[model samples]
Target: AAGTLIVGGGQAGFQVAASLREAGYADPVVLIGDEPGLPYQRPPLSKAYLAGKTDAEGLNLRPASYLAEHRIAHRPGTRAARIDRDARRLILADGESLPYDHLVLATGARNRDLPVPGADLAGVRQLRGLADADRLREAIGAAERVVVVGAGFIGLEFAAVAAAHGLAVTVIEAAARPMARAVSAETGAFFRAAHEGWGVRFAFSAGVTAIEGTDGRATGVRLAEGDVLPADLILVGIGVVPNAELAAEAGLAVADGVRVDAFLATEDPAISALGDCARFPSAFATGLGRDDTVRIESVQNAIDQGRCLAARLAGRPAPYGAVPWFWSDQGRHKLQIAGLAGPDDASVLRGSGDAFSVFRFRGGILRAVESVNRAADHMVARRLLAAGTPLTPEQAADPGLDLKALAT
Candidate 1:
């Protein structure tokens, strides 16, 4: 009997499987992955991998021997079609059914496609999986000019890589600023300047109306302003839609993602969700007495949720209380964020020179921290937030009181 069945073979699924083994859960564990390779890190795809600093082998999370030695059954290139809740079985594409005592839906997400006239052109691409990255790397190496369709994290990241390689890169964003939804305007401006310093061009408030191509090969992108920008390659880094279709089809409630409680358990107690696909309550905030849905798409979130879920599944039922953190490597600067900040939150700048930290405040209460090229600050923020330490804006503004010192 399949003791536990994981429906995604990315970070979360692999992490939970490992955590279960570490916690002394000997029941059979099976990981099902739609992707055709060993689980790997997605963050490097936009940075190290794109820049040729790392290869596929370097990005793997686990080796084949490790999985085998752990007695974990890994099913690669196998898709879980549906979940039969009544029978406690998972339907596979190959007409096979696997019985599970506990189920984890870590289906992750897929890139949102560019809906335009020439979106189907040969050169148009989206980077969500390994296959997408492989195609992007090959296209970038051969292209003279590339048009990026978005100013989000993925778009800017790919732009940085392209610019570092001395390729002519144009980034088009419908929004006014970069990472407008995720970071403060100050941080966005800082990143914009950093990318600009690397010779990346931006077209803010511009939308791609169509992708112009010839003979099914992309040649240019038409903007909303009736302007056509010529390009040999087009990379669409718009955003990603959660792969919650499976859960929805299985009659599980899916809002932005598979909705889970504070314990990371779905409405069905036997089923749990994590990673980019699970919309669980913010444990850090909720434990501090704030109730809100906090679905995050970061490596840190994936790992923490996976570990927490595993601990609970192993009969230890610990409330999922993890501070959300994220990082992005753009050019020489590393943008790190600790905690979740809302759009209306006020931002205060701390530190100076090339390294700085932006403290986000909501009603005089420290909500989050965004640091660029300041690893120490990011670490401190994580610790303080996880420890439920109170931080005021006045304290954050004081340069003498470093984040690390305050945390101590």
Candidate 2:
């Protein structure tokens, strides 16, 4: 009999399989992935892997032997054509069917493609999967100048790597500041200043009209005003879109992603969704007077949600509730965020300069914390948020008190 079937062999899918075995669920667990390889971590693709600091073996969450030893059957480079909910089977692209008792959709996401003239040029690259990263690493080696479209985390990380290599890096952002969607204005300004100090150029409030090229190879980027920024390479890092088409075709609820409840379960009992593809009402948000749901895209969320789902399937039923956190490494700076912070959340500054934290408050209650080069503050903030500990803006802004001590 089938035990558990997980679609999409990314971090979430791998974690779910691993967690199931750890929880003593001894049934057939089949992980089907469209990618060709053992499940690997995607985080390093734009950073360490791109920078040549780490190799492909290091990006792997588990070695191939571990998967085989654990009896977690993984179908690498195999795509799931559709979900047969009524028959409780997953239809493969090759016309094979795999029956399952429980299904976990960790379809994840794909990088948003740039729609403009000459976007399909030879040197125009996007960093998403291992293949993309591999191509980009090779491209960067011969590139004299790099132009990045978008100022999001991925864009900045790639820009940092390029800038460090002494390449002329120019980042174009349609928004007023970097990371406008994720961080507050204060935090955005701080990062902008930091990136500028690193010899990276920024063109904020600028829209890309087209990509200029010769012989079908990217050579430069053309702005909305008809001015072209010369470049030998172009990396588009403009966020991502959930791979929710399969779920939607199967008639599952889908908005920005597959909509699930607090338990990460869909309306149908047999199927569930996790990671970047699942949009669920957050307990953390609700506690802070936010009635809506949020779809988080991060390694931490995927791992935590996978473990939560695994436990429930192992006959230890519990609602999925965990404080969300994320981190980004841009050059020497490590920016970490604990809990979810909305755009309109009131932000209070704690500390100053290179090492600092931004306490985000919603309705006078601390909702999230964004820290730059402050690992201790990030850890403490996570604990406090997880335990529902009260922390006022006044207390957070004061440098005299110890944030970590209060967490305990």
Candidate 3:
């Protein structure tokens, strides 16, 4: 029963534990989490959960009884103080040591705090966990005006919800467009216009100097240009920082995150990392003549990495290479991206308006597809990318062509 010790009871951690059991690994499986409840899906925290469409119980990734049935020793409300590589022990905050033959780090990431004056005000909040969502839901119900600090997915999604609640909403982004770092310029413009159509105001290329407070609560936000926008509540969704200090302290190679090889294994043979915390060289990138590693913060990356690592640990060693995909729900639009797209990649638009898709090509080969409300195109892109099928921009832009047929 001396086997896998998984730190961080998140999607990746829970998947690894379940995958091990599914692979018939009859050993001790311990999953530790700093949160007080069962692992839950995080995407809903900003979307459905914040809108009161779903409750905390609905956010649970799996039923509470599932852990008991799988024989996974899930320690909730616990934190790992440090990892001893030589001793193969995980030291807990309460002074308990857990021995393991293999260790997996799914530590994930934390919400980056807004470091500015009045940031500690009562009405200012950041959404990352269940508790954060609960507090935000209560705040949104009573808020008259909501000011969002970033125009990323979380910010836009929450802004849509706030707007739906009949509250005045304004989103301030330091970047020139919404989701500038993640999506292409065309896709960013589409979402920006879509959000605007839904009664949301945007302040692009705008910097926040400070938050204005009154009676220990946020009253508004001060722009870099000395203009103050009034708001009753403020939400910060700038970005996230990987929780890789635990692995770095144990001498694991860490850059933007814990650097891993193609197999998702760290420098230590017995230790591996996955999910948002692992930065590994992507096979997809290597095919495109880039050897640099990437740290993806999507559920697809986490679940795929977990299953890949599980199979390898269970005597089915294979390099981890899965076509990454992501989706975000904002108001009436459902934006989906299949495969990875670099900043320099050329984009070709197909269709138009809300039902169109943007195909990204690097050196005449399709790299990624960003589809807005086009689920069929997204599904086709996933198959095409996974098969490594060469797609030309001309073929993608042609309305008469069948993308799904070409993929097969």
Candidate 4:
């Protein structure tokens, strides 16, 4: 088979194949994925799916017939062993091989393992894909005390779900505050207060030393301070490591991820990478006074990058320059972020109570906005950032100011 070969049938890979067909590119597109079943949306895996609000079928991006109709050759439950860059070939783990005119290494990222004792015990889980969510859903049903390691979006989202079940949920974080690396201190304080109000406990500046197991089942988590948090189920959401080993082993430059340019193209013109696996230059990063390259792990980034790459492959080239955005649904409240921001960015407050937006500025330039239960502000923020619209700190702080009008 020739045409484009997409290695990883996640959102990014599927988008590329779909977009190529939509763009009327007459080529035999093949998408090989390691996960069994139709390609599905992952964001819901930690929220609605885990909370029993949605099922596996609801998670799919499209129906099975859509792939066939689009002429996308879906190869599920297949693994790519390595790439023969010299020959433009992809070797499968099962000793099969396929050649491609263009290759997309959208292999995505994998959950970083908790390197501690008794981590592999039963009842200890981590949510990344459907299987993990299913196991966790079962484990959560019979668990009373639930301890979540890592205070990132995944952990907090899981905590919200567990706490909703009336379970005693405690979140342990190495950082001084939850989501410390992403949001401003003020925003973190707001969420911390909200979580505490939900009867959810938090252990800040903490580390997990080991997982305590009894009868080959996780019973608790031992902290570094020699304190054990008794639990029937433990969920580890520390972070993820980019699955760029396949690209690296095949002689592609990989730092934290597969190195790509603003066009989302690797050094070799024949190959490209995107999603969580490719670290490409981002305009938002430069505007936020940070490094140019950023590898985002949101559904927005994957879809945008896939569409951008598809345009390029369709003979209409344009640099990938979409504004970065993300969201987290914690119980009744929602947190939305638009654009990239650093720790040192200035924070300005707007709105009151649970409905507010934290505007981040760097060098007097609006960089990012963190909206809590303020969808209107989040929507306007994406436009403001994408268009590089001028918004002053004073203006952002003014509650009476019409942000929607300004953005328009």
Top candidate on lDDT is: 4
**Cα displacement (Å) at residue 357, model 1:** 0.4
Candidate 3, which ten residues in sequence have the lowest lDDT sum? Answer: 283-292
Q: Taking the tens digit of each residue's C-alpha lDDT, what string does model 4 give over 118-211?
A: 9998878899999999988987888999999999999999999999988999999999998988999988998999899999999999999999
lDDT of each: 0.89, 0.91, 0.91, 0.92
Candidate RMSDs in Å, in order, are 1.8, 1.4, 1.4, 1.2
Q: Which stretches of candidate 1 lie above 4 Å from their native place?
A: 283-291
Q: Per-residue lDDT tens digits of candidate 1, residues 362-398? A: 7677778999998988999888887878888777777
lDDT of 2 by residue, 1-408 (tens): 788999999999999999999999999999999999989999899889999999998988999899998999999999999999999999999999999999999999998889898999998889889999999898888999999999999999999999988899999999999998888898899888888888899999999999999999989999998899999999999989999988898999999899898788999899999999999888667543345788899999999999999999899878888999999999889999999887889999987889989999988999889999999989999999999999998888787988778889
Candidate ordering by lDDT (highest first): 4, 2, 3, 1
Please report the TM-score between candidate 2 and the true structure.
Answer: 0.97
Two-way TM-score contest, 1 vs 4, winner: 4
